[model samples]
Target: MSRYREFKMPDVGEGLTEAEILKWYVQPGDTVTDGQVVCEVETAKAAVELPIPYDGVVHELRFEEGTTVDVGTSIITVDVAPGSEPEEPAAPVAAAAPVDAPAEEKKPEGRQPVLVGYGVAESSTKRRPRKGTSVPEQPQAAPAGTYSAPPTAAAVQGELNGHAGTVTLDRPLAKPPVRKLAKDLGVDLTTVTPTGPDGIITREDVHAAVAPAPAAVLPEPAAEAPAPVAAGERETRIPVKGVRKAIAAAMVGSAFTAPHVTEFITLDVTRTMKLVEELKADKELAGLRVNPLLLVAKALLVAIKRNPEVNAAWDEANQEIVLKHYVNLGIAAATPRGLIVPNIKDAHDKTLPELAAALGELVSTAREGRTTPAAMQGGTVTITNVGVFGVDTGTPILNPGESAILAVGAIKLQPWVHKGKVKPRQVTTLALSFDHRLVDGELGSKVLADVAAILENPKRLITWA
Candidate 1:
């Protein structure tokens, strides 16, 4: 007679293991219609809003806000048939059978409830209770609007309270790398205070457990002395998760895995700057954003067109250089979440105006933190404009799975020899970093040279294209 249907969290981003529940849009007893957003979650890539698939009245929220729940875990339970008095939520109990009982159904991790009316699959087996630790009898269900803990919660509670010796199947909530770190440092997760969300242990927690700092006892202060600062006031710790965590892992992987070679060129882009001003005045680009970056992107496209061999990826498994005929130009955008490189797909085919529009949209979407996982994948080349920050140039790292990354420096008025005369000109520097395995020094130089040539003489964009 129970109408409770559980909703498990879906993998919002590409193969993300878990997501932190940033907020709950619906609470118990609130009605939610099909396709209505129930909650917002933050994954490793970005924040996403999840919608319920069918009409229902929220019965209970399994996890609290800020809880990092594994994908496929039930976050909410809804009663689809709220018109009638709901019976006790037997779905939770009926989901699993005792270990002593004969097999009736398979474990329901495969049911993958992404919608409203999906059945909660039954578990294949249940662990036996600990000796001398009596299992509590199931309490009678209160009327609707009350909540009950699941079996997993009950077992975990038993282990934590007066049954430390009990053997349970539950593993400690730490990442594999963190587990390895704890093992290496001789720290037991059971003794560490988890600072991460939803009872999960973090690297800092393990480090603290292994090498705890002795509390600094301050002497009583004098009347004129400033009050002794608390530990929180001295420093702050931000959990490195979500987009920032993903970025760090990627940078480390790319830096160690690939052999990078960087080449720099200082060029006078006075012509390119003049072209930008002209483009702004032209009626064709009336509403679109016209800036140096736009011209820079066009020059890169022209360079890539001339030196097609530079657009490639190194496949270590197959021992081959995968040369791509198309170009997915990644533009690095710094967002509050983190640095994400979402590329313009098939950029080689887009005209200058179209490229400008795509670039405009990409920047706006990234600034608003709405860039999707798809937009950031399958990039062949990337450009990082550290120039906007007034930096000269950097040996930028190649984006993973891509062959090259171009770094553009700030443009300033500097003395330069033009037409055999030393005069102030618009000058900027460019650094090209490429996968040495895929692109040799000669090929890398050609690509960098072509780009510099196009920028120095904006007419090359017409000739090359």
Candidate 2:
């Protein structure tokens, strides 16, 4: 006999309760080694790959892919002693199978594991008796492609209904997540044509059903075809499960929990723009990202140095203000999954060239969806560049637990008075939103002013730093 070990789902993110199994790399009867990635799960924060802790033979997969399992639930079972014969599959339970079923039991529920909110029912091979009725027992159908026995009438009916008619019967074959998506989109699974393997309904099927078809063109004498009766859906519902859910919760918490105070300043950044062009031509700065955002970030860091009091967090539990000696600069990035702020660790200690390298790497990693949870934590301040979208400016909310967030607006050529003459110069607006409890109007204004002063005269970076 082989000893079996159940591998439970661990909390991959900070206190996340559940994660949806996206893909399984191994199946039963396959040999696996220690530290091998067995499955990928998507938590509320990000998609993470879970590796097996020890080497063993895969005994069973507890839940099907696309199922959301709670943390601490066993996801896979492994057999350490593999020299022995593989264990026989567990007998199917009666609760999942109808009465009068054949002597050969239904497929085990262990394959399609019970949902997170449901408990496992008792196992019984025999069916329960019904009052005043005795349904005749139906013989189980032979396995597909087995010529030993002919297909049963039930199997014929299942084939007519677009399924193999083994386990799914009349109900549509779909995972729990797909079902939830269908319900959200107001789509009927029975009406949807399944394109998945074994007639299983997929997310794409639901989305396809929601999309409206192109209107048909008719000849003048064709009586108009009665407008086609509007078959497609008007709206599609998407479940708030993974990264999107976390972003919504964080935004709500930050907005209501903290009293935000915003201050804005418009300044001439012609010198900063000129500096950006000059740096791009410099040999040392070649192959590095030299842009307006980089100069803006450097300006903000110089401002923080001048007013260190503004770079502190409010300790509500301790009833004291906690001043941070170092800066872990966070750059707000928007990815396909959701908006995530992955900070550059110890940014205050980095030189101009080093900062440029870190920024390039951070953007690339975020775009590729490879940012880890560790990169998102422990941030003191953030900078969101809404200017890339050609927007003027926005009052950005503070990142949770942070003191302030700066928003950079589009820099356009505007008429400005320089040396008592109106001239076309590069101008942009900056908005700084901070926690009022720790940062008052005076402190906020000073920080915003310093950033503007540097952009107005690029030489001030050396003087201020």
Candidate 3:
């Protein structure tokens, strides 16, 4: 009956279970309007801001910064009607129904509980007796089966009054979500001891049930003290979580699961470099980012068009390979959180300038940590410009769900044979790594060769298109 409304953390992207709170824009007692941005959170792929759905005065911030909260859990509480006095809900009575009246008439309609104070009760309800009070030491039948019952045990049923709730010791008390958690974890609720208010089992209690019980031992005797060390001087442990954790798991899975075959090609990109300079001066591409990466991405797209078989995915579970006609070109970007690949949707359909603009926006969004999870999914192929890090080239690992990835090395002015004469030319190495299951050596070689050819002659971009 209170005016307090709680806002839960939502699943921002594709079945993401949790997110770490990065920053809060509002404090307690601050007024917020509907759709007002309240807090920023970082999930496995990117950082996102959450907005409040209704107007209210912030009453509480449930978690601090850097705390990872599960989706659907309340993270904030607000008072909608702040000036009005809060109304307390009717208190529950844990007592039995009248023995004279038939218990069948006292049955209450069952509803999934959201709080931890209700039990999985059926016909007869049994409430746990409160501590410190005993009934009697008088002569009775079997001492009332271990202990005397409370006087309140003979109270009315839930149906007796429309407002009162009943609790029983015969069954486990848990909310629907906690019950699901218990079921998912394979923990029997009845065996778990309740630590919640009024002797109800909580989510923590259910999780603790699955943990290995600590071994017991006698207390150790006093021992010599070791040298005192300053905090963080020896070592600091950073918990693997968020994007970094997802990256680790995905990389490990892809590395072990895929049979990778890498093909390296050192190319002369002097013409491509010149073309990039020309594009910078073009009026049609005004205010757009024009760089070698833009050209490389375009060249890769053109190469995919030439050899569409390389844009594929190996479906191990179905024992099939998926050939994608449209390319969601993934650009591997490095950010403070971790490396994320936010791909352009339908990159094969975009024009040269459109592709360049998309590439520019993708890079900027990734650097600002504002990319969405959807942008990071459904990629047919990827390009990792390790060149930006000044590395010549790397044998890049294939992204999960994608069959191939291309690594672009730094373009340096090198002495090379051009027109059969030794001359200083802009040169770079390109490495194409693909899954052997989907792309064989011949197909992989063709894709790499096409990219090299397009870069070497810059005119091929038009002829190939």
Per lDDT, what order, best first? Answer: 1, 3, 2
lDDT-wise, the better of 1 and 2 is 1
Looking at candidate 2, what is the lDDT of residue 381?
A: 96
Q: What Cα-based lDDT does every candidate model obtain?
A: 0.75, 0.74, 0.75
Instruction: Show the colliding residue pairs in model 3.
Output: 96-155, 126-168, 126-169
List, residue by residue over 1-465, the lDDT tens digit for candidate 2. Answer: 234656778766757899889889999999987557788888876677676655678989999998999997899988755665534433332223344456464432222333221121112122334566574444342221111122223333433343222333334555544554566467888899988753567778988999632111111111123333356756645667677788899989999988999999999999999999999998988898889999988999999999999889988899999999999999999876678898988888888999999999888777777776668889999999999999999989898889999999999999999989999999999999999999999999999999999999989989888
Residues 144-183, model 1: lDDT tens digits: 4323222343333433452333333233455433554566
lDDT (0-100) at residue 292 of candidate 3? 94
Higher lDDT: candidate 2 or 3?
A: 3
The TM-scores, one per candidate, come to 0.70, 0.67, 0.67
Predicted structure 2: lDDT: 0.74
Segments in model 1 whose C-alpha atoms lie over 4 Å from true places = 83-117, 120-232
